[model samples]
Target chain A: MATVASNQRGTGSRLKTWWTILKISLEERFVYRGDFALGTLMRFLPIITQVFLWYAIFAASGKEKIEAYTANGVVAYYMLTMISRAFSSMPGLCSGIALQVRDGEIKKYLIQPIDLLGFLLLTRIAHKLCYYVIALIPFTFVFFLCRGFFENGWPEASVLCAYFLSLIMGFLLGFFMEASLGLVSFWFLEVTSLAFVYNLLNFFLSGHMFPLDLLPDWAAQFINLLPFQYLAYYPAAIFQGTIEPNQVWQGMALEACWLMAFIMIARIMLNRGIHRYSGFGG
Target chain B: MTGYRPSYLNVFLTFARNSLVRDMSFRANFILQCISTISWTVMNIGFYLIVFQYTDSIGKETGWGRNEFFVFLATTWIINSLVQTFFMPNAQQFSELIRSGNLDFALLKPIDTQFVISFPRVDWAALSNLFVGFTLLCYSLYQLTTKAENPLIIDWRSILMYPFYIGCGTVIMYSVMITLAATSVWLGRNQTLYNFWFYITNFSRYPMEIYKVGWGMALWVFFTFIIPVLLVVNIPARIMARPLNTMNSQMWQLAGFAILATVACLMISRRIFVRALKSYRSASS
Candidate 1:
């Protein structure tokens, strides 16, 4: 019992250190308050353009439902997607990590007592916290504006819990996947094109452009088998209640599996990269 | 003044050649960039393929059927590729230039500051999109002519007008990009320029008819009159895709409007750029 208490105390202090880093990260984010707010709001402009396109599609088709989706349901899916994106999207994180690896800045983490992955994850958590804090008002404004478009008002508490869990996993999965991509910089002198290619695939495969459900049956099934769906589509589907209650647990398990797989990939890449790393200059 | 500033054409050619040499020096990176751009266009095509499987047309009232819509998509790629190749890299560097006080050096140059800043680098890899877009446009036109009930008439006149309208699109896109880039002077570090640019240009990719609904009218007027991007892709795509009977008067009107909008956008953006320059304090200041 005494040993267990000591172990608990050790874990507590470790978390406290990370929590302090998170606080500093959050404070650093506040330096660009106006940029944060304006950038978040402006990102919604594409969604508005998409909404117009969908409105036109439904109007022209004169169909209340398209592929098991009502217009309102579709709109609801997009709104939920914004929330999922808020959690999953890590702007410049990949390139930032890649630059650190390329420029030998990763040596600092090696020399320091801090763990790089732990530091990055905590910093990311802080970023998301501050992002949502700044973005909540705009999100509320847009949600209220889109209230009329939601056929089902609110999801069940159980569904919300699952959805929230999926979002957290999505965040982890996104981070690890990009971190794995960034670790490639240890081998390649330039990772810009690789980053671009990754973004192109991610933007399409993650269902940021449209709902994965809108894809053909085979395509949707195949995408579901991949990890990208958990990043955006699965969480939105859970919130939309498109996935049944029984399937929610299964989806969460898959998300967890993907998160684990990505974490492993990142670990392997980081190990190999650090082994291969050569300093540019003394 | 250095023999009439080396002639604008000579200056641009020199910059372009220098950029090409720099690009060729990194052969593997250049090839990868080409692959990346082509893959993005292909993925976009795959997306539209699934969307079109559900609906016959993008905007049914506007007659942007699969082939016609592809034409519009192709036109978008063409114009966007040109902008990305020639201007985007320069615009992105504008903030860094200001931060480093390199703009002062640019101002000291004998040639036009805008010209020097805008075309100092040409992204050769983005030209890959131009080839792909052109091929897609040709294929779509073939499908339209052979498959449509009323086949499109590709006259010599329309053929001549196509490049001119494409030039208009490029100018308008350039104006908007430079104007956004100039905001860095006042905003300290305009890191959000790329996102804002993407958001604004997203409208130009689709048929403008979609923006005719409820709140879209306001957007339509805003993008049409204020930003004038609605004319960018729409006029060129319409001229290429619409039937000859419908194209006669509407074609002239659209062509005229595109020219006027291009000039207006250029003038307004130039004024904004000049004003931003006046407001700019050096890094030391």
Candidate 2:
């Protein structure tokens, strides 16, 4: 009974530390309030261009539905994509990690009581929370203006639940995948070009440019098999209720599996990287 | 003031040569950057290839068919590559200079401050995009001319206008970037420069006609008249490809607007940079 109580106390203290870290991160971001707001709002500008591009395409086609998407349906897909991207995107996460590794700043975490991965993940959580809080206003404004484009209106409650789940999984998967890449900095002195290459692949494969369904059958099939689809395409598809109710479970399972795989990869890389790490200049 | 002033062209050439030496010092990194940039362009092409599969034209009424659209894409790559090569590195480095008090050294130099800040470095890897874009433009033009339908007449006037328009586009983009960089003086870190840059120029990547409807009409007016980004790519691409049904008068008007926009943007950005410099207290201060 005493041991159980002690274990509970340890877990409680750890949670408190994480909470404090999150709060401090949030407050730090709050200092840059104007940047936060403007940055969030500016992200919507590209969506405006995308909407215009899609409108022109749909108007040209003169089809109510092409590739299982009405004009409104396509716009909704993009809007939902923006939302999913907000969740999945980790701006500067990889580069920050790589820099820390390269500059020997990773040594501080090793000597300190803090777990580097846990601390980084918590900070990211705080960052995302802060981002959504400030960004929710602009997001609401944009989505409200685009309300008419959602031809199906609000999706069913169950689909919304799955959509949210997929987004969360996507966030985790993206984080771990990039974290693994950052750990490669233990080997490569400069990961900037590699990171850029990674971003290029992520941008295309994650369906930021267009719906993956629009791709040729074999290409789409190949992309679907990759974990990249979960990052943007799958979650948007879920929000649009384009994924069948029966298939949603399978999709979520795949998302979870990808998340687990990435987590393992990140852990293994960090473990191996630490053994090879030699601290840089004093 | 000294009676003798250094020639700006000679100073610029020296900066360019020094940057080349610096880049080549890290040969593997240089090669990697080139590879990374080329891979991105190829991926972008693949994306458009997929999009074009769905529709015969971007806008059926506008006649920006696949080949014409490719010309526009290539033009974007070319102009963007030039801006990225000549100006983007310097603009990005401006913030770092501010943070590290390196701007003091730059200010101490005996030359035009803007010229010194704007041409200190060249991203040679980005030149690959120029080469790729030129090839793509040639191929797309070939396809357009061979078509049995109304083909673009390659006149000396348009041909001469194209490079001028491209130059104008580069100047306009550089102005926008420098203006953004200048904000670091007052804003301290100005980390959102790239984000804002991406947002502003996103309008330039597509045909300007797409921005002619509903809320997009507002963007068309704003980016065209206010910010003048729509003029950057459109004027050059339209002049070069002569996409079907676009009038020569419209082309001339756009060309005229682009030239005016370039001058206006440069003046405004220069004013902003000077104002921002006045506000600078130095990193120590």
Candidate 3:
């Protein structure tokens, strides 16, 4: 390959490659069509189980409100949680990075022209964009099918729009954090322990199953310091109106702050990790 | 050198040993895995309790109170975890072995390639799910005995039938994994089946009865003919409840399903793999 001068074309050309990466990933996804159909349906089973649990809670309280959340509000909260979860890659991307490093495939990327971290992060974004579009179908059908399953008002829509952006921010925060942790593989052959601790931290802090409001104030404050809340809670809070729309922008701004800090941390980790790669891989 | 074939017994032992060694190498992985998986099960158990702490029952009709839900969930958890340990990993890797052109590596061995690939790795941590499920069963049983209008003790008849139920469940789960793994042949090079299967396996974690009867029947077919998971879950729960009659075909269905699933998985996989091998030019292309 001839040396090519880096110029304005570099940015344009890189963006073009990212789009091409998307096409390749989509084509790659087609091979698993069998899974796409049955797998998508199977994904909803957990929500069904969870909904029943929430239903039990509503029934037991003998009142529709639990800590100021109405029955429909609670249901809608989980439905959004489930939908956003379908878009999540925190645990998966973390584990994938570890596996790549364990198998020495990360070395392959060192020789490549494009940035490995950039390519990986973009690949997941593109893949999830496609996968979640498929998830949106059943999600919408379920949203409409259940009677009294309402999506609040214009305030709610605006909140949801903010929530959607926060969701992207959440994914980024998670991706960068995990990628940074995965960089630990440069020293350790397996990062499964670190990955496990991270995942447990994710479930408890992100509010994947239950919202942050459900936790005690101190519990809430502890997770608030971490980026995990920005991953699931901020988005979920906006969806449930738990934090109130009057203050929703604060959550959005917080999400922006977490994402920026995470990205910078990831770059530092990557630079230091690559220098220590050592090449004596599995 | 080219025409070697080992006995099926040898293949089984080799694959079993290989997976065991791989798992043992990461000694800490087993403990971490067990803790995480158990934590996940505990999370759901906590969720189950939280729900039952309220409304008392669903829709006021099914009226499945807490003990019943625990019993049902315990059964689901055990079957779900057992299947995860037994078949899911192998199936997930089967797709990978094909996609990465690693199938050739598996095939070149003296043993049957399918047998070698099928059980090449085991998740020792997933065994924690099995332990948690058993504990859940014991807890549920105590709850049932104390809370029941009539305290029902564990009966021998039910105990005997439970294993039968578990047997059927394993058969069905294994069959589902094998069929999807076989799809990698035609798929050429895609790990989508692996991810798709992992997502679906979470289905067994929930109470299967939540599905409407029509959809239940559809899932029954999907689980049996397609996914066939109830081969592990529904059967175990039914046997513990009592022997099946026409009222609940789960027990009878499992009996038949196990044999049918096992044979179907073996034969169909053999045919597809042989055919796939005939056509594949492999990585050299």
Candidate 4:
């Protein structure tokens, strides 16, 4: 009985520690409110170019639907991609980890009681929360302006639930995958080029550039086997109602599986990296 | 000391040599960066190839057929690579120089401040993009001449004009970039400089014909007459790929305006840069 009570107390204190980290991270994010808002709005500017390009292409093709996507559907897909990317993108996370490892800042995490992965995950969550809060108006305005493009209109409640669930899984998957890549810095000492290559691949394969279905059938099948699609494409396709209902659940399960695998990979890398680390300066 | 003037050519050569040495010192990084850049270009080509599978041209009678569009893409890569290799790294560091008071040292030097600031760091790895662009351009030109329904006539006039327009495009882009960098002197930290650069340059990547309709017309007008980035690749690509007689009178006028815009952009950017320098409050102060 006494041991069970102590275990409960320990869990409570752990939650409190995470709460403090989350609060501080949120505070840091909100410090530059105006800049944050402007940055978010500026991100949407590229979509204008996209809309024109697709419009021109569809007009040239003289097709109501090319590759099973109408002009409106393609535009709507891109808009949804922005939302998915907002949840999954981890700017500077990889480089920041490399810097910490190289500069001996990782030593602090060793001495502290905090788990490095948990801390990073919490900080990222706070960042996303702050981004959504500040970017709510811009997002709403953009979506409202382009509402006509959404020919299918609002999705069913069950699909909507699955869409949101897939997005949450995507967030986790993106974090762990990037964290694993970052932890490679322990051995490499410099991962900038590697990170660049990874980002280039991610940008294309993740459907941030265009829909995966645009690729040849073989190429699409090959890329779909990889985890990159979960980053942006899967959630957007879910919202577009392109995937069947059962397939949506299957995709969610697959995404969850990838997330778990990446989590294990990150934890393993961190452990191995810590074992290899040696801080030089006193 | 005041009478001794160093030759600018010699100084530029020295900077180039020094930058090459620095780049070679990090040989692995240089190789990896080159690989990364080439991979990106390949992927970009692949994406466009997939897009073109569904259509004959980029727009309705826009004349940017597959080979013609590849010419445009290659031109973009060429101009972008030159600008990035020579100017981007230096311009990016302009704000840092102000913050660190390194601009004081630059000002104390006997050479032209702008020249020194712009040419000190040459990212040699970026030259890989130039190589890839040239290769693609050559292959696409071959395809146009031999395989297309109407074979392109490659004339000596176009052969000479292409490089000249590429030079003009590079200068105009550099002018825009340096002017943006100069604002860092006043803004103290222009962290959004690269983002703004990307957003502006993204428009130039596609053919300008896409912007001829609807609200896109507003953007076309703004970026063309006001900023004139639209002419950077469009004029050169059109000149190379399309027959001269087929070019509308408006295109000829725009081509003429490109040269004027190049000179005007250079002069205006120089003025803005000097004015911004005058406003600089160095870190020591």
Candidate 4 residue-wise lDDT at A31: 93
Candidate 1's clash total is: 0
Cα lDDT tens digits for candidate 1, B193-260? 89889988998888888998777899988988889898899888888887645756754776797899
Better of 2 and 4 by DockQ: 4
Worst 10-residue lDDT window, candidate 3 chain A? A147-156
* Shift of residue B46 alpha carbon in model 2, Å: 1.5
Predicted model with the maximum TM-score: 4
Whole-model lDDT values for every prediction: 0.85, 0.86, 0.68, 0.92
lDDT of 3 by residue, B116-174 (tens): 76676666668788888889888877876676476556678678767766766666556
Q: Best to worst by lDDT, what's the order?
A: 4, 2, 1, 3
Model 1 misplacement above 4 A: A1-9, A272-282, B1-5, B248-252
Docking class for model 1 is medium
How well is each residue in A87-194 modelled by candidate 4, as lDDT tens digits?
A: 889998999999999999999999998999999999999999999999998899889988999999999999899889888888889999999999999999989888
- As a whole number from 0 to 100, the lDDT of residue B231 in candidate 4 is 92
lDDT tens readout by residue for model 2, A1-282? 998998899798989988999999989877877767777777777777777888889888777787979877887888888888888888898999999998789999889868888999999998898888888888898889879999888888988888888989989898998898888899997888878888888889998778888988998889887888888899999888777989999878877888888899888888899999988667
Q: Kindly report the docking quality category of candidate 4.
A: high
Scoring only the second chain, what is candidate 1's TM-score? 0.95
Task: List the per-model TM-score of the A chain.
Answer: 0.93, 0.95, 0.88, 0.97
Per-prediction TM-score: 0.94, 0.93, 0.72, 0.98
What TM-score does model 1 score on chain A?
Answer: 0.93
Model 3: CA > 4 A from native: A1-75, A82-148, A151-161, A185-189, A212-226, A247-282, B1-14, B55-64, B97-117, B120-125, B146-149, B199-202, B213-228, B241-285
What is the interface RMSD, in angstroms, for predicted model 2? 1.2
Q: Give the TM-score of candidate 4.
A: 0.98
